[model samples]
Target: MDHRFVGTAELVETPSVAVVVDVMRAFTVAAWVFARGAEKIVLAGSLDEALAWKACRPDWMTLKDGPPAPGFDLVNSPGLLRSADLGGRTVVQKTTAGTVGALAVKEASLVLCAAFVVAEATAEALRTCESDSVTFVVTGEHGQAEEDLACAQYIARRSTEPETDAAEFLRRAARSRAATELEQGLRQGSHPDDGALCVELDRFPFAMVASLEGPLMVLRPCPTPSSTGAART
Candidate 1:
């Protein structure tokens, strides 16, 4: 346990760490939640857990879930989060993949959210930080979604080769062959924009990493678009 980087699957060993990636949509939405400005987030592994949390603290949270059908108050759509008033509110999110992995690693010394959007920062943090192990957690369709794998690959590239063209690697990741392979793996299939949107880098900087406690997740300020240059930092 020298370093831990989370990917989509169970785990892997790196030069000084392990990476687990869930690139599809879980971490994607996490970036949004922070960008949109939520005071806090709570990750729930199951629908029942999410509901119970919501029930106990009705005023503190809203629910997010999804898939083939709409089953919760709000789905895992980042677009929806922007306009929602999550001020001083806690969001209890139950995803098909992300939350499950998050639930298992309640003891990650440094559990940061990993997605296409937060890939750069994750790499940077790892390069400078000191940890026994680094884990990359990918929240995808229960081991589906090649987007996360590609993101993992990109992260691997960055951690190993700081001089590599990060942008180009990300670009290649955006349209990876794994995307096609993972899609083909899905029998019923995934969402329409699952592949396209998952790979968009830095769409929002809000990086939501997990805490070493019950259900809580942390938010990190992501670099915003430069052209606009509106909000400072």
Candidate 2:
């Protein structure tokens, strides 16, 4: 796979298919949900939207979690998911960084939800695609960070020719403004519960793939490396 790791908004302009990463929390949790057994998933940009969707279709089933900023029900919580009954239902989720970044990349023909837990699965999945080029998009912590960069580079190292280390890429993308915003987010102490929930590996067979058509939260068991399959939570 010919892949490039791009660490900023500049990636929006890049023509290659982009894998939007929210590894520290968001996408990780989505992967976890798949492991549990969800039929489909949706990535919402706002709490209101997810909740409203849930209200309109109660039986459809939804996982409503996002930044507990304001007008939000709960932050992303993995512990909560473990106990809840998804029953192959659909989830509408938002988060501090994950969903928003995901929404931005939804325009891509193939937007695969990604994180550290499924790093190898994700990397290997992308390597099999027909796209001549792929890009790892770290939407960043707040907007840029070492962690998301590291996660993206993780894929870059495995599937592409990486020109930079995780830290360097983070430094290049972590602007003073973005860093301050990211720091303020840490101080808010708003979504602690959600962080712990999204870190499980191969937790979900669902890939949480998104697109202009909408999010396709495909659910299944862990892909047999021999089968080489991947889908969204």
Number of the predicted model whose TM-score against the real structure is largest:
1
User: Number of backbone collisions per candidate, in order?
Assistant: 32, 14
Candidate 2 lDDT tens digits, 1-233:
56666654665474447777876556766766666666556776666777777788775554444334543333455545555566667666666676776666656666776776666666666766678877777765544655577667666675554232344434432433433443455623223444433333344443345655434333232353544454433
Worst 10 residues of 1 by lDDT: 224-233
Q: Using Cα atoms with residue i matched to residue i, what is each candidate's TM-score against the true structure?
A: 0.71, 0.69
Largest lDDT belongs to which candidate?
Answer: 2
Error of 1 at 123 (Å): 1.4
Stretches of candidate 1 exceeding 4 Å from the true structure: 1-20, 67-71, 138-144, 167-196, 214-233
- Alpha-carbon shift of residue 216 in model 1 (angstroms): 5.0
